[model samples]
Target: MAEGRSEIRLSPSLRGRIERFLAAAGPALEEFPPLETQKLVSELYVHQMELHLRNEELRRKQVVVQRFLHRQEEIQSEERFRSMAQTAIDAVISTDERGRIISWNQGAQAIFGYQEDEVLDQHLAILFPERYRAACRRKVERRRFSGMVPFPGKAMELHGLRQDGGEFPLELSLSRWEAGANSGYTAIIRDISKRWALTLALEGAAHKWRTTFDAIGDGVFLLNLDYEILQCNHAMSDQVRKPFGEIIGRRCHKVVHRRSSPIDGCPFVRMKKSRRRETLILRRDDCWFKIAVDPILDDDGNLRGGVHVTTDITTMMLAQEALKETLARLKRNMDETVAVLAATAGSRDPYTAGHQHNVAQLACAIAREMGLSPEQFEGIRVIGLLHDIGKVAVPAELLSKPGKLSELEFGIIKSHSLMGYEILKRIEFPWPVALAVLQHHERLDGSGYPGRLPGAEICLEAKIIAVADVVEAMSSHRPYRSSLGIDRALEEIFQGRGVCYDPEIVDACISLFTQKGFSFGQEPFLILSPADETGAAQGGPGPGREPAAVRSEETPVQKGKSAAKKSGGLEGRQ
Candidate 1:
């Protein structure tokens, strides 16, 4: 029955099924022509089937090629990320919110001395020193609560632990990072030993600069552009007579002078504007400060502020002024002394008393009219008084001789001018006081005595004294002659103007005497003696002669022995 069932069925449905199945199995079976023809047809069908299978295989290969290219793209992308992570200098480390290390790059390994295998899946606390663990944990808790790390672009210096328990300084910048569905922190760390060294060096430099500034002996002050005192050393307070606590952080003008603001001539402003050092004279009560304001510059050459250095010059300036005043006083005192001395010396003759004083007064009047500085005037006054100082060495008998002097006696009297210079040259004085005495007899045209210097060579003071000597000797009663009137005295100077005397000075003298009605006898002379403290001798203040006080300054020569000397010597001499 099995063999019969295998035979072909004649029912139409079954037969069609069998035929279709046979044709599918072998297409040549449906043809069933001759056996040999069928074999040939089957061969041809098999050849076609083989060709279709080759086409299917080709399609499958194309799909495989596309998949390979897609996979290669993925591999390249992963390689690029790995390369960046491996070569980056800044440590790239990732940790879970709970402080577990999840990923670590080569940079992290190099900086922390740990391999990825040693740190990955480990607690983040392993990297922190034991002491910092609490702090680090607290920071992480804060970060988790805020969903942000405290550090971003700004890096914080800290210590990093190595795999071998070693430590190093590092700058760490932390940020929150998300990987797929997981949250973590990324920390970028840089070894910063070099930066730390620089920071220390900068601190040291700052300390040294402050020390140097404070150690200076001179008064030092720092001011802002607004002339506000920023800082000051102890010396500044001492010099200005103000306390440092009161001066610092206050406007300089207000603190120094108790004013509301800076004055127009404030030196700090000028220094800041000019970016250069400027010197100013500061007047305090009876003292002076030379304030030098120098610009403070930054490394980039920008003006930052100013440095004020104040030098106390009150002593030196006062000394100079005192010296000037002393010379003046000395001249007047000397004139009075000489007048008294001459009176004593000439008491025997009686007629020659007050001779030197009259001559000196007339000479000073002439010199002042010639327009000289106070120093020059003082020189003239001194020479006029001392012109006869050497005559002290001359015989009293010859001086009081009443009759006309012999040629030898006249020559001896003429030698007094030279002798006076030699006597007075030892005394230190400004403006060649002794030279004026020596050259008093000299003429501009070289026609006078004692090395007669001509024109400019003759001191204006000497020329004036020469004119005055002739006038006073001729006008006053002398032992040998009668008095000549003032008009005759004027003629000598007027004729000798420019040729013997300085023309301008001679003109001033002429104006004073002739036009200004100045005369030696205008004021009566008061008696002065060593016993008279109120007198014009002994360098005390006289009746109407007093010194004017400088603003906010103490007198250079106070009312003491020095003051006495100055006042007594120069009183009424000018």
Candidate 2:
């Protein structure tokens, strides 16, 4: 056993100490046995080698424990990374440099409708549309997958193919990793079908709105309170004869109206103040423009801005102005013709030269005082002016006679009313002038005239003229009679009120003479030259009566008689 273990080496310190002990006790222990000494050295050397072997055994076990612990930590780290990747909302996929799918997480299965076992080792091109497959293949060939490719591509939008063969839009982010000499790629992908559709819908709606705005034919624009043209349609450019570049963002008055500022009473100003629609008619150059401004409001009912619409109305307005001018010219011509006709009739009886014309003035005044409208009174005036126009048909001797005439002459005098109707009925007057003329001598009780028509059958115009006629006839001087004065003429109508005349008209006539200052001369008359007078006479006493002196209360009746008078009383007069 000693020889078997004798190969064990002695420690340097033990060998050195044993040699020194022998040297110090030189020959003192020479008597000790060689076998015992060899046995003792061998035992010591064996123990030292055994201790070093034991220490080496413990170190080997320690290395094994450290390796096992480090391996567990690595396993835990891998599990943590896998758990994070699986639960992510986006698809997490891994592929080799060959572009074959190597790893698939739960999100990848959910997004692509595939189990993890279904897609491993498959080409990554399966996830992309056919059009994008070739581009991805090209990127893979370059071994630099970035920017719209599979590796290190930051959030790029691309088409994705699902297990169902349906294609949809997706957002993808890419990253690459290296394991030894080989590389792998990870892609984070998100389905964006709803988001993409929403973006497209918004764009379509905006395009449709702009199209509708450009379809209007009239000039239309949006305006703010400051008169800035916020937006305008295509037609607005045509109206102002400018391009959209010049008009938009400029003031409306400056762009459209060609003014430095808004004009007085501008429709835009009015619309803002009133918060309602308003219109303005403007004449620019040779054209007429009608501007319609409508208000725009906020949801809270506050005035925000306005919409201005413009229309061209030059043709219509110009026609109206021309028609008005033509009518005026026609009226002047008619007046001249009427003057000539009035002068001709007056020549036949000198004393009543302006009688019909003066009757016209009084009749119009009475019609107004009675609350009659302008339409009613205007007709009355024309009828009164030409009331006695038929006297021209009667003999001068009969009309100018000083005393009451024979029954034959009286009948002839009464025929003048019918004759006046015959003369006027041929003309197409807007009013019933002819009928009123024939009924002027007619009474309410059927006690007078060529027609014995009662009050109800008489036109209101004829009644008004009758009151004025009687008053004028009795008050003015006539060749056949002296002036009876206005007091008696007024008394005549008052006494005949509701009997021979209309009560309302009588009251209106009285009010004029008493309450309102009315004189027949207040109106202008058609006066003929002395050359046209011929046998016409001036105002004075008639027949055997001397000229009456002017009384203090001479009365408007005397002055009015000069406006209209008959040769005799109601019994016989023209």
RMSD of each candidate?
16.6, 12.8
**Every model's TM-score:** 0.56, 0.58
TM-score result, candidate 1: 0.56
Per-residue lDDT over 398-482 for candidate 1, one digit per residue giving the tens place of the 0 to 100 score: 6655554556766776676787788778877666767877887787788767885666787766767776776576456544445
Relative to the true structure, how large is the alpha-carbon lDDT of every model? 0.66, 0.77
RMSD of 1: 16.6
| Candidate 2 deviant stretches above 4 angstroms | 1-218, 256-261, 285-288, 350-353, 368-377, 392-397, 405-419, 438-457, 498-500, 524-574
> Which digits, one per residue and each the tens of the lDDT, describe model 2 over residues 1-574?
2322323456797777677757765766766667757866787767878866866776788789999999898789879979998998789998999788988999888888999989999888889888878778777777666637533555878889999999999998888878669797888899898999998998898788878888887789999888999989888888898998898899999997679989988999999989999999988889998899999999999988999998888888889899889877876776666666567678998654577877788899888777888878878878887888788888888878876567787788888889889988987777898999888988899977887889999888788878888878777777677766776677667657788889878877766655465677875333344344321122211122232433435443443333233334443452
Clashes of each: 15, 8
The best candidate in terms of TM-score: 2
